[model samples]
Target: MSTERTTGPALVVQNLTKRFGERTAFSEVSFEVAYGEVFGFLGPNGAGKTTTVRTLGTLIAPTSGAATVAGLPLSADNGVAIRSRIAVMPESPGLYLRLSVAENLSYFAGLYELPDRRARIERALRSVGLEHRADDLCRSLSKGLRQRVGLARALLTDPQVLFLDEPTSGLDPVAAREVHDLIDALRKRGVTIFLTTHRLAEAEQLCDRVGILNTTLRMIGRPDELREQLFSKSIEIRTRAPLADPDEVFAALPGAEGWQRSEDGAYVLSVTDADTAAPAAARALVTAGADLLALTPIRHSLEDVYLQLIDTDVEAQQR
Candidate 1:
């Protein structure tokens, strides 16, 4: 777990597949995580997100395909080497309830055989803001604090690649925000993070890019890129009164592909480009003698893209 930086992708997966007996956990999944990038792994429950983390963490072997983790080839022989340079923080922190916070960390440090154990422990505790609670029993800590302890344990190795599985799965807003802040700080320090979570908003806010998986990778890109890929660019226009001949007005506008009246009595214009279409739409509205109340671009959230893709998968399976 040397802190020395590397020059290539922190992780590289090529057609990696895993199976349990006849059941396929995941298949033909491939992606790369760049150094210092926060790469979000998103999916619904039972979608093999954790399995993928475990496989990449060298906890389990893939059924087929290959991968490079922490700048080392993934294989039985290299498992030790790969693991030494990476850390996995599961949804549950899995601390010894009876052990004090510092004791729990010290136990794990021994497992890692990390030298300068005292200094590393201090630094890890400080990183997660748990230094003050070092002497407190883990059983007395809140769920959020325990999660921080788990994070501190993960940092004990000073991993090059950190895999986080649902880090804030059940945290309250206040606690989740604290974890979010810590993660943002880590990103600033250039720690490559592979975050798996069902929380779409968290992923959208924190991830540099995200990959949506449902047994297989459904999509992978930055939030905006995925939205543009899966949704049509559109502008929602609200007028004081409906145009008498909406079709006549919008049909003549450049960049507008089509128009529709929403159930809420607003006009939504499909466009090739919102920037180019907004001005044209405003001009068209004024010419039609309509007082425009609002002309706003429609933004699709990561949740929208996720649902659309997952729903499509469900429909395909039904067929």
Candidate 2:
């Protein structure tokens, strides 16, 4: 329901770097976020995920390089304009505790100089399912509710780009789920979201693309693309009976790297191509007097890929 112009990418970063005195927070980070896309920024703590967000949101200037957010160049001269078009929800909700939910939102709306401030306030509250609690004092709300208030405040300006830094950090599972749903809804409506979090699963679930940052960018691509780049396709099959010499039997399958029995008793086969290997695996099993119960291609999880990359990087840095 935003009237903001949609042209090309919603955000673009080019070799962006930030530092504080002698310490470098992040360096040479670069990636672009397409309009209406949820771009997830992921890294371990101190990986400069938050620093990158701060730089892009115009909260802090990069030590070098440049970025254009929502078609506006990010610089000191354009900082005010850039800030106006983007809303940032920091890791902490940062709400005025004594103020009521409506009051907190109203204050932010006024800062944006929005016309019909009250209507926008109502809409923001409704968007986050806090309409019923609009009059409740922020101090009395649960942490989850306070987070929702933060989200509503972000919506006050109907920003073209929304930055959410650990939006669900401290909430219970139910509260986290609620926030996830709200984000999903916003994505469906074509709002661009820049999210940074330690939750790889959440990134896998919500982002159209993700960039793994750790002082520098490790990788940037779609979740499935990253998986494919880092792992081989595989297949898993359960048998009505135990596989006879699964290692040797499956090793003969097309592009097979041999097979191992999983803890669940399923034979997991590592192969170069599941498309060509699965059929051959089934045929080989049948010929070997094995009863194939179920055959499923192994899908690489985001966590698996993330850990592998992070561990590899850490080991290399140490060496």
What tens-digit string does per-residue lDDT give for candidate 2 at 212-303? Answer: 88788999999999999998777989989996577767766779887777898988888888999989988988889998899999898889
Q: In model 1, which runs have C-alpha deviations exceeding 4 angstroms?
A: 315-319
Q: What does candidate 1's lDDT look like per residue over 1-319, in tens digits?
A: 3457777899999999999999788899999999889999988877889999999999999999999998899999999888888899999989999999999999999988889999999999999999999999999999999999999999998888899999998999989999999888788777889999989999999999999988889899999999999999999999998889999999978888999999999999999989999998999899889999999999999999999998889733543
Which model scores highest in lDDT?
1
Q: Number of the top candidate by TM-score?
A: 1
**TM-scores of the models, in the given order?**
0.97, 0.92
Instruction: Score candidate 2 by lDDT.
Output: 0.88
Clash number by candidate, in order: 0, 0
lDDT of each: 0.92, 0.88
